[model samples]
Target chain A: MRNVFGKIINTKMLYEYVSLQRLLFLLSLCLSCLYALAGFTIVATLNYIGEDIYGYLFLIFGICFLLTGISSIKINKKKSVRILIFSLILFLIVFVSTAYPSSVGLQDYGLSASLTYNMIFSIGLIIFGLIGALLSLGALFNFKPLGNQYGAYFLLVVCMLIILYPLVIIIGQVTINGAPGITWEFLTSDVRGLGESGGILPAIVGTLLLMFIMFVIAVPLGIGAAIYLEEYAGGHFMVRVIKMAVSILRGVPSIVFGLFALAFFVPIFGISFLTGGLVLSFYALPMIIRSSAEALKSIPQGLREGSLALGATKWQTIRRVVLPPSLPGIITGVVLGIGEAAGETAPLLFVSTLIIKMPPNLLGMVASLPTHLYTLFGMRGGLGDEVEVAARMQNAWSTALILLTIILILNVVALVIREKFRKEF
Target chain B: MKKKLSKEHIIQGIFLLIASFSIFIIFFIFFFLFKEAIPAFIEVGGDIFSTDFSNELGLGGAIRGSLIVTGGALLIAYPLGIGGGIFLSEVASVWIRRILKPIIEVLAGIPSVVYGFIGAIILVPFLTDSFRMISGFSLLAGGLIIGVMTLPIIISISDDSLKSVPREIKEASLALGATPWQTIKKVTFPAASSGIFAGATLGVGKALGETMAVLMVVSAITRAPDSWFDIFESGPVLTSLIAGHWGEAYGLKVNVLFAAGVFLFIIVSVMSIISEIMQYRIEKKFKGG
Candidate 1:
């Protein structure tokens, strides 16, 4: 390979080949470098058009430049070279933008777009900075492919979990702050008013009630769907359509489902936790059906045949033979459903609104973890709002943590059940 | 045939009816969304795509922003997810795999709000200063955060698909003198590609659907892209529009938000449909028991 490259470089015909390869590589590098030129144009255009060209052009162009730079990172995945190139590109943007400002003497402390320009310009720099650092490291040493792949993969998962860290922090913050504040008065009291005067007793009770009602509403129906799909229904048009619909439901935003439920079911039932439960039921039922169907499908066919051969009725076979084995998955589905139900906010938004004081009865107003977060966050700039928001955000986090733990525990149970009913090919 | 169905048939039909209702419910959601959105779209000057807040332009900026953010995040996520999934399904020692699997599972349930908070508190500032950039909030923060959010979706689905790769195929590859890695590369990936692709679609779908994290982190600007590099800039995503602007926006403005929402709904619905088809193909590939 070296001899080939060497000969290709030195020889007449092959010299062109070598130069062409080098040219392509150089062109790619240059393209990355020139990417920041867009930022320059935006800045220049801003200066040329006058400082009051307030169409958010600075921010828009800055973003475009950053994207070009990011796309340029893939130009060379060989490591160090990419980093150097990315840095050069980023420097070009910053240099060009700053130079345009200097050449035109345009300095206004980034108040042009309420600091949007500064934020966008900085984001562009960060993109380049990350690429530069990683690419530089990648350049300095010949990073082994698998080793790098492993490292990248590690970062991806850790990053993903850490993405949830904000919620967890809020949870921790809330638990430490709000959990302690949960006196009997707090528990029983209504949100009579804001700021240190009211308790969350009604809210808690309402939340628990919603959970209970949703479970009651969703679980049975969901299981029935699962059972019907697994054991009874043939591959009929209706069955297939139903299955597809369920899959789509799995995609529908929980908020939309809440809206639909509010529109379709709430009026018929009234503005109670029942409405919340009904909405959540629509949301949770699909999951239950899907998961339980999966569990049912997983049960060995031989067991069903065995039961049938022994004169067991289909119901008896499913209940006595299949149901026992599939219980774990069913339970897992239920637990997962609860976890989802507890975390949901959008669907509950219209179905349930914040009541300052708790509901007078079961049919009265309600609030859950999501609603609580929204309440705390959306209190229209109330007093001590910063600390108050922080405290409430913390409560939201703690509630989320509690919700997550419940789901995790349930998943553990499900896995154990899946293992117990382990099917072999 | 008896007029009354058999006990098994009767019970099953009931179950099926119950199971089937979920699809109807989902349909109802689409109906409601469209109903509100359509009237609202008309109410909001009837423009199919307009983000003209302060006379900005068609949600062109948002579309571009979401694509960049989601795309960049996917660029980071897909390989890591599939590769890690490959390792989980094939290479890792049992103990390591045992430990890692549970983490992926747990990671899946961590809420979007948590993910947002993390990105805002930790990732946003670290990225901003470390890069010596302008502000903590940008497309980069949203992408990185979303990349994390989408990982479990990709990993779990990819893992499931990769594991579904037949043992006989593996044995055949070994018999043909291929090493484990080579077998995984040459044989398993091809077979599992459908599942892996489906997982990728799911990941993208989830990233697109994610609101709170994106809302907390991404810049909520409404302007046209002046250059291709806007991928680094934080801007509104479709769902984020609903949450961010719903308060101040009423009348046609709210309807415009719904129109943007319609785009999101279509994207997700179409994605699920395609993936469902792909999943069916994968199952068909496995053939009869």
Candidate 2:
């Protein structure tokens, strides 16, 4: 690849020419992929053979991990023995855990696999850790060293895969579970209760309304603040203080903000969509202010001077020239804030009062998807059948996916506007 | 020519006035918490801090947990976020940039709740297996999850900062016969440090303020970590403090949760202010701001 940058290098030579970094990165990726595949195969083979065989396989790997400590110690140095001890202890625990009798008295995991999955899941984890330790020791001892970048790439990509596993599962499971329920009827209808398989239409309505109103409350205030700091209140103590305040607001936990809404806002304004919107507006502020300020700052002063030379008023230049250019940045901030607002569950908890029947105008109690999902999963023994709950869960994912999609669209729009301003100007 | 006072100026003034009132809203948040929180302080008594109460309200332990978890998350998140940002800005090919941008978008767009739900279902089990049974839901798991959550913010902002680095500096470094990495390490990174640090502090803030996911993923224990390496032990952060204790406590105890909230607010505010000041100093020093 590097050779391609030079015209002197032959095209055929490119096949033979690979950097040590790239080669090492590739090898690490393959090794990790193989290790993961092997773990998966083990799980599959165990699952296929049933409990008795699975238990024995656990016993084998368990002993392998545990016994390596002593034999290795005898053969190798004290350092190896230490590694052996750690690795031994690690696998022994996994083995002991896997060897434990099934919950609910010697049962085959059929239907509702949360417990079974959680219990059996320990084996894969042990294997991964063991491999990681082994690889680290190998790397430490390797005559041929992988450079830092290669090593970093390997670790980063592997960790990312691990993090994305659940997301992959949710995206898979939800679409499979909820695709059938996403009828026009389901999207537009109302959910009466647990038994009703009615669509989350009302929930969607409530979410959109909440997002729109939150945007309404947040954007102008946030933009004004950005303007104050960026254009008006430059290098002032109060401006600096306000900027600090916005950053602080960024870190204020949503749940506490939820509590804030409950303890403060509801008493002042009463439980309603308005309160949820207000709370969400707080969640939106920091990102909006930060991004908007960045946007305003991005507009070159030369453009302002050019406009002023044409006898444009300062306010006119700001409105016609600066605003046109900064609009994309403002929109980026707005979209990001919307994305944050859409996911908020805690604040809505306080603001929505309790379990809402439906929206009672602007001030009525309502349920958003995150809060509804929280109730379904977090609140035990509350919802309908697994199928129904699964359906609702799917709906929540779809709603989130939909929300994400909109943000994506908005982001593209912002990018276009920014790029247009950057180039066309 | 400047416009005289008119309806539009008045409207704009009103808008600015309302926006400025956001400061009052913040003050209100602090004031309300302080008002509600005094009862709890009175209940706990000022003397409580003079002696360690090994089995008391666990407030001290909760603070320790917050520091450990939030700090741990930053430690792990910082290198990846900052390094990746540098790579994207300086080293990466156009194709890599194209791929990375949307991936980050997906990452940045994913809701914290979904991240929590995923953490609860997948990561908890994965950690339980990977670590020992007892270690899965520990502070390490919480820290790791928060690290992932904070990555997009750090990456995006640091990338912005790095791209903001002057072309002249890079050319100057290369002119001195420095490697690309050397230029990045010595010139670009140092120049961009304040902005990158600001991004990091924001990541820490996100990690600290994160509730639903950390609340679900971490074991809800309120114990001070014995050592820095004892991150694998279950513990509570300040964000988790209210959720962890609010249900059990009544009256002044609930007020105690508010006090914790005040503490959280103070922490978040202080860190952000530090980052901003760092940024200002750097800009003023280097760019002649």
lDDT of 2 by residue, B17-118 (tens): 755666776787888877887776787866333212234544676677777777777877787677667767877778877766766766666667667766
**Model 1 CA deviation exceeding 4 Å by range:** A1-203, A265-272, A355-361, A379-382, A385-409, A412-425, B1-9, B41-46, B54-61, B131-135, B219-228, B231-234
**TM-scores of all predicted structures:** 0.72, 0.75
lDDT of 1 by residue, B55-131 (tens): 53256566767787888789877876776677677776788777777667666666565566556655676655443
**How would you encode candidate 1's per-residue C-alpha lDDT over A1-425 as one tens digit per residue?**
35544664478865664354444334433343343333334432222233323223333333443443344344334442344454455546544564443122112332111223443553453344333333323322222443344334433443434333434554454455446545566446666444234555555666677778868878888888888887877677777787778777777765455546555676687666777777877777777887888878878899999999997777888889998878877887776776666666766766566666545356655576556545554552455646665555454444444444455666687667656655522
* DockQ values per model: 0.22, 0.26
- Highest DockQ, which number? 2
Give residue B116's lDDT in candidate 1 (0 to 100): 67
Q: What lDDT is reached at residue A186 by model 2?
A: 59
